[model samples]
Target: MPDWNLVGKQHVLAAIAECDRLGSRDFLQRYRFGRARASTVWHRGQEYDSKAILGVAYLHATGRAATADDFTRGEAGAVDLLQGLGFDVVVDEEALAAEKAPRVRKTTATKPARASRSAPAAKPRRTTAKSDERVKVCPTCYMALPATGICDNCD
Candidate 1:
């Protein structure tokens, strides 16, 4: 079976669980009914937008749509599918954070090698601008001229 990330799987399961709890038939229907009848759904006194809930439901449903692979062959609902197949879907926030954290490479400090006394110190090279280049300037206005050398405001 293919390995799945816990964070993604958890989000899918949460969406499915919410859908089941609300007795929603499908994602589209739920969204339409919520929009037309009730604009929002309250959970634990906190009001959540119906569209947001339906959006999450749709994502979970579509995410588990592909069953051609061996990992999710018989799965239907995101939550039921994983649970029915005996897949341990545990979401550890700390582990997920650790996984997302940038990896730092460890290295031992080394002493710098001394420069050879025989070789003379190299002088820094100075860069000089070429004086032969021609730059057109507007005669009417003392401003830098374009390719046509025509002043926009004066000419």
Candidate 2:
């Protein structure tokens, strides 16, 4: 499963207040484009489009939109905001239902070929060991002993 991190409730409230005070232009410029683009902001703390998220939350609370669809960034913003805030929100059921209803499916199983009709078997792999060679090996370790009849590991 994917991991999620949510901002604390107190932090969210403070952020929302800041967003409300800033308004749309300020919110977009600060978060969506300008200083929000700074890597330090992400590394240090949270910086997101508060206005958009707040709108979504309102739509969700009011039930004006389906739960699943209601949580969009454009319409409700709250769901995303809540997600950012670490809330486990249920997906909008009606939107999910609508999406699931339109799915097109085709199921067909093909028969397998008969064993008698199969292709010939492939050859087996070969070992490098040769019968004619005086291959000396350590009896205890099953390792090839050197010409001096000494196994380095056994010694």
Query: In order, how many clashes per candidate?
Result: 0, 10
> Which digits, one per residue and each the tens of the lDDT, describe model 1 over residues 67-154?
1222232222222334433443333345445544677999999967667655578999988533223334445432334467686456
What is candidate 1's TM-score against the reference? 0.20
Best by TM-score: 2
lDDT at 81 for candidate 2?
Answer: 52
TM-score of each: 0.20, 0.25
Candidate no. 2 TM-score: 0.25
| lDDT, candidate 2, 1-155, per-residue tens | 10112334543444455445566466444333222111111112434443333332332233121222223333234445566656444454465445445567798898887887787798998875321233344565433345688975578
Q: After superposition, how far is residue 80 of candidate 1 from its true place, in Å?
A: 22
Off by over 4 Å in 1: 1-13, 16-38, 64-155
Candidate 1 local Cα displacement, residue 15, angstroms = 3.8
